[model samples]
Target: MKLETIDQVAVIGSGTMGSQIAMVCAIAGYRVVLNDIEESSLEKAKESLEGHMERWIKKERLTEQQVAEAFGRIVYSTFLNDLKDSDLVIEAVVEKLDVKRDIFEKLDQLLPEHAILATNSSTIVSSKIADATFRPVKVCNIHFFNPALVMELVEVVQGPHTSDETAQTAFQFVESIGKLPVLLKKEISGFVANRILGKLMDEALFLYENGYASHEEIDLVVTKALKHPIGPFALMDLTGLDVNYYVRQQRYEESGNEADRPAKTVEEKVNKGELGRKTGKGFYSYT
Candidate 1:
């Protein structure tokens, strides 16, 4: 499958990453289908995307006509079968391996043989993800940073059986959408960004749990002192404490080391249903 010639794209799981990816593709002149299990969530996602476009129009970044065209290019669906004609798919489903594996397996069965199956997984390796699916050669990781519509950098991780041509095509596709594409020679856990952030989060967890500083204090030091756009606490709140904790826990177990263990506090907050912005509270209050 040629990247430039790709006619249709599908974004599975219309949450933060999926919806934004669909918007980016639509804006880039590709017909996109954004699929989720729930119809209500799909409606909510369209509203959210419209709001995102409203901001762009307000800033003169996107004209009203452009906004209408972008929204018109997107098709929302509640089933995987809606992606039958899609030439490429970006799965931004839950971080759970089983959930991802099931989704890839279904796509493999339904999609064309040449379709590129990419995962937006931050930490999990693509090879393992491919092992669970039948389309190993077609599977690769196109890990986009948060705010996929704005973040310019994208990491393309190659699985063990991934064809060289497929990897190159992914880079071309990223460039088509005005994203910076960095290629990994091979697959690695976390791709790149999260691998770097994971270490900082580890140390930050120790500090917060050991009483070195409060969450607000920690956030202030990083964002104000280090000039980071956001600190770990703020990031956790934005990313959802439950989601962040799950990634950390998985990475820790994959590392097979006590040092990589997730912080007790992070886990406790998640267990209590304080899942950051989604729940209105985590380390900080959202409302």
Candidate 2:
């Protein structure tokens, strides 16, 4: 389908990324269907989105009426079939290949043949999941950073199977939503931004875990010395440690390299359900 043809958008999984992505599309004047398996999750997502929009109003980034109209454009649903009319579907579910492929396969069957399927995965490439759908040409990675509503840069990966039209449509759609789109001619495991950030995070974890310095000290050094807006550890917490753990796990499984394995601390926190801001604790405590 052409860029102009994309009207209604669907986002699967009503977690943080999914909710924010749906809001982004809604704010851009597209009717959005945000779907999850649980009605409770959908309700929670709506509540969270309202809170976010309220903050935007307070910050004067958006007016109350604009927020209301954006919210009105979004339809929260528990049924996958509700997405039948969506011209594009962005899957923001868990960072597991199996789960993503399952969603893509289902979306392939539910959505119209012309619908484009994109993943908001930060690590996994779209090609790995595109094969699950019959329309690999319409599949591409539209990786949005954490807090999709706030972040401006979006990485659009045009995999081998992705058609020029599909990649251009995704790029234009991202820009149409007011986000800057950087096109990757080829697909890599982490795309561009994350690959560089991942190395920094790896080193930070190594230093902290090896007793070179506390996470707090390392964060201070990065923020003060490197002049980064947020330190690696803090950023990981914001992004969710579970996401980092899963990403590392996926890498280890792919490379069979011990160094690519999730850090022990990250694994422990994920096992204990302390997944950063959402859970109130991760590398640091939010509560």
TM-score per model over all chains: 0.96, 0.98
> All candidates' lDDT scores?
0.86, 0.93
Candidate 2 matches the true fold with a TM-score of 0.98
State the displacement of the C-alpha of residue 51, model 2, in Å, after optimal TM-score superposition: 1.1
| Overall local distance difference test of candidate 1 | 0.86
Worst 10 residues of 1 by lDDT: 253-262
- 85-191: candidate 1 lDDT, tens digit per residue: 99999999877888888888888889888899999888777787787767788789998888887889999987778889889999899999889999997777877
Over 4 Å off, model 2? none
Model 2 Cα lDDT, one tens digit per residue, 1-287: 78899999999989999999999999999999999999999998999998998899999999999998998899989889999999999999888999999999988998889999999897888889989999999999999888899999999999999999999999999999999999998899998899999899999999999999999999999999999999999998898898999999999999999999999989998999989998898878886
Model 1 spans with C-alpha error above 4 angstroms:
none
- Residue pairs with backbone overlap in model 1: none
